[model samples]
Target: MKSRSASKITLTSYDDLLGGVATLEDVREVAIDELHSFTDHPFKVKDDEEMKELVESVKAQGILTALLVRPLKKGGYEIISGHRRKHAAELAGLKQVPVIVREMDKDSAVQAMVDSNLQRENILPSEKAFAYRMKMEAVKHQGVSGANSAKKVGKENKDSARQVYRYIRLTYLMNTLLKAVDENIIKLQIGVELSYLSIIEQEMVEEVHDSTGKYPSLEQAKQLRKHREEKSLTKEVIRLLIIGEPKKKTSITFKQDDIKKYFPPDYDEQKMRSIICQLLEEWSNQNH
Candidate 1:
């Protein structure tokens, strides 16, 4: 998908131009001296070979796309998106890459960066957690601010504001699992469930996780969680089984006719059958 540009918005100072236009010449390559990885927007460069190929391609084509950046009050610009592009530019021996400058408060900057990354087909679970957390915090700030106003934002925006509350809750996770999540070693929704486990519990969960290699469904994780809570299983014990499939609580279903046909004519027994009452009657009786 084509990235949307905020180039139309012009500003007088570099800070005000945080979300505005930036040209290649206007962007500087200050010796890679003071630049740091974006704290809020973290992602790993997946393929070194691919990145090298990208650098070669970029050198040949001259950075076909520009990176999105926000102004830092101290110095240089915060890269909101196109991290790979920046790395490729460095490898390509480019002095300065094209960029779109924009004014984004901390929260807005994080959300913009995350939103852009989420659009990608694949992103690390750790990356998702941080990005999701950033967006949620931004929405939360917006909600708190809107609450004080007489003309407050409507319910939809308010709901939108709360949409990521649970996702953001994942940020409280310990570094090990957080790294696992970021590495795409664990599923996002599963990571959310794992997040509910306390720090100690999460460590145990991680043990099972590491032993399992690949996580089972969330249902299995929930069962492991329950088993730990109820039976007080040792972490090692849970690790032994947690990676495997969960047990089926109910038997598989088969058509009654199919079962009956397989049996002899006189094999009917009351013990073999169970019944359910009609829901319509139950509803009518409840109303009456």
Candidate 2:
């Protein structure tokens, strides 16, 4: 094949596309104060040890990569990525940082924000929950089907489509229950089952976990959903599912066969009983 002649790139052509403003790929120094967090940004910018390291790096070398931002009608730029880096720059006492300006609508911005942050290694369940939910809605707004949206969101983060939908279910949970999922007190599957309950019902479940140190097993959570569907999941029903029915003047009864081996031969029955009570109280406090 014959070699094709190369065409020269013109700066004027780029300026025309941007309506006589700076080009899309232009890296400009924006004052740190002028950059704002993206609206309803799902990802967190934490000040943990990793953030401290980022701050130190910024202090020494400045920002190696430019942040992605778009101009807002309100005068400041909205950060689409590099929230942690921007925070680090603030902490590192930098007055300005480099940024690349792009024009994006809200839906596109949400998708971009989610895609960039999902690449992090140490994200919480709640973060993934909200981020996936946001990105899925954004995709659907752009006219994608629910299944395809889930697939696209999942592929971006190496999660299965089913897993993406599962994560989004967690968005239904109340704050306390969601925090429990983040803390691993409630497993993901159980959280999904519990998520079907109404907010008031979830508040009851949170109460059960708070007053008594009991969380739902997977089967128990499924049963809770069954009761929820029947519209009979009251606080009393929740309590019963969590800790089981109370005995008449419930006692910490121990079967002699099961209890004898745990205590020393020299210990009296009263002493063993007291020690067991003390241990149970400690466990309760820890869970509380």
Candidate 3:
């Protein structure tokens, strides 16, 4: 999708401007040092092999696309798009890189920021969770609400409303569990279930995972949810429920010496046994 330029609104904030026209038309060389990262950027800028390739590309071909940025209230530009390109340029040791300065308000900027980044091929579940939530709020701030809000954001991201909400649920998870959800250690459904758990209960579940090496099954997660009361859901109980019920004992044996003391010395072995059974039957009859 084509990016919107800041020039649609007032462009007076810029200390440096090529023109007061389309952002696409007014590209300028911004000092790599001056461009700050997008605030609360959900996407990660990792130094992986993809970045190595981008660095080499920047070193050789220069920045192909101008970064989209808006002037911050503090006096520097906040990057709206082309975060990877900016990082690559920095790695390439370039003093200045091309940028398209635009006038974007915070809500529009946040929506645009997420819209731009969601175009990436591989976004972690956590990233989607937070990004969808941020964009949904931005949508809400713009007077979009109810089902329409999810549809507006989800339509942009190629997801259904329910799928968007499912992704957003991961944000409630503690970082450790959320990371596991990202890593696929916890299945998406299970993660959603775990999200409903209190942070302390979730921590207990994490402890169970760490101490017992048991990942929570869907049923176990449901068990956690069903027995959510703290009085009922102790750590050991969590462990037992997660690990499943213990096996039942099939047979019990008693040593002959242990039973021998209860019998009379005058009675023969067969008589002793018969008498014991008779006495047990009599006792059971009395009790019953």
Top of the candidates by lDDT: 2
Give the clashing pairs for model 2. Answer: none
Where is model 1 poorest over a 10-residue stretch in terms of lDDT? 148-157
lDDT of 3 by residue, 57-144 (tens): 8888787767779998888899988899898988999888777778988888888788878878888999999999999999999999
Top-scoring candidate (TM-score): 3
Per residue, candidate 1 scores C-alpha lDDT tens digits across 77-168 of: 78877788788877788766656556778876765666566666666556655565565556667665443321121232233333344445
Regions of candidate 1 where Cα sits further than 4 Å from its true position: 1-36, 144-187, 208-217, 227-288
Alpha-carbon lDDT, every model: 0.60, 0.84, 0.83
Which consecutive 10 residues in model 3 have the weakest lDDT in total?
Answer: 9-18
Model 3 TM-score relative to the real fold: 0.78
lDDT accuracy of residue 14 in candidate 2: 28
User: Which sequence of candidate numbers ranks them by lDDT, best first?
Assistant: 2, 3, 1
TM values, all candidates: 0.58, 0.77, 0.78
lDDT of 2 by residue, 126-164 (tens): 999999999999889999986998999898789999999
Which whole-number lDDT from 0 to 100 does residue 46 have in model 3? 92
